[model samples]
Target: MERLKLDYNILVIDDDKELCALIKQSVTKENISAEHCYSGADGLILLEKNDYHLIVLDVMMPGMDGFQTMKKIRKQSSIPILMLTSKNDSMSKVHGLRSGADDYLTKPFDMEELIARIISLIRRYTRFNFVDNHSQPLTYKGLTIDFDSRSVITQNGTFELPRKEFDLLLFCAKNQGRILTKQQIYEEVWGESYVYDDSNIMAIISRLRKKIEPDSGTPFYIQTVKGIGYRFNKEV
Candidate 1:
């Protein structure tokens, strides 16, 4: 059986009118629908009103600028963001990444590289079912976790989890109620057949718990098994 490719809506936020048109044209060639916003304030408004699969943001803009705009958007949504910066703006690029931009490219960028980044971000951040045997969508409490999107959301907020945190959460939830030993979690999450003497396992567990547990200091969902590993103790 053949599967249909998922349709995605992308928001391009840049003040450069000609460059915006070029980006739209290039993305359309790959069958992605795009919307353009020429101001940072307008971009924020549009984001609040509609859900976009991805956002292509220019680092330099009027009124709010990309960094500030990104920070504002992140406070409200977990949409994928790809930043556009100048070739000499490495420091700002790092700041963008840390501030939650999914990926980035330098201005005077190669069209092919831009296209590739657009495809990559969407693939890692949109809601869709995969045909090649991937993890299914999961819900815990009021939170919905999407493997395809690599994101987690609840009534209170949405967060962009690191890859390891997402994978660990999925693993624990999959085997809910079972006490998985440290060895088991390490091997499963790290994909290593051998064990190493590192506190990495505990660190990852603590990180995951902080996000999903309402009170990580007194966790109920993820309970430690005393000398073992942990368990997802949801009553289902």
Candidate 2:
């Protein structure tokens, strides 16, 4: 099968000049344009001057690290970020995710896996941004989801969710009353095949329930289907 050519620019922030060059060369083959900077500070400056579809950030850098850079970027934009780190510990991965990274890849990673993750992040981001004129806002009970604007509203007030959260919610809302498996949700929302354990999906669902459910302890909208997966209750 012929691969679809992607026309997107990505910013690579890493002090390792060799790796940056390699990543640029690799992604260019897939029709992805990449720009690189040697430092986090320089990366921030470039980000201010140009628009990028996604970011490939190295965790360990001189002065400001990837976590610090990610925090700064999160203050201004919700652009998808893929963090590259040498640390393989679970805590480091958790920290990266909590610091606004969309995905984390440890060093000495397979180039193909890195490319796959990058494409998945970009595709997921693009899918959410693409608006359909024919689709209408979905309202159930007091919760309202505006697909065109990519906003969610509840009885509490309007909430602006992170990219993954919004995508997961939209998927569930669209398939209300249907039992969605973990693999199904992961593949659909993440834009990749499910490989990791169920913890990732479980965490996202827990977070989503907190945001939309009146009582997350007793989630009314998103119901657990026991060991199977979840079902967005259309009858809520």
Global Cα lDDT for candidate 2: 0.82
Badly placed stretches (over 4 Å) of model 2 are 132-236
Model 1 stretches with alpha carbons more than 4 Å out: 1-4, 127-202, 205-236
Query: Over the stretch 105-198, how does candidate 1's per-residue lDDT look in tens digits?
Result: 8888898888887776576454232422566766767667877788878654677788888778777665554456676677768899746654
User: Tens digits of per-residue lDDT for model 2 on 1-236?
Assistant: 12336688999999999999999999988888999998999999999999999999999999999999999998898688999999989889767765567678899999988888788767656654553335667667979888766777887678788788888888776555555677768987889988968888889889878878889999898898775577788465
Error of 2 at 184 (Å): 24
What's the CA error at residue 140 for candidate 2, in Å? 18
Q: Once model 1 is optimally superposed onto the true structure by TM-score, how far is the C-alpha of residue 3 displaced, in angstroms?
A: 13
lDDT of each: 0.75, 0.82
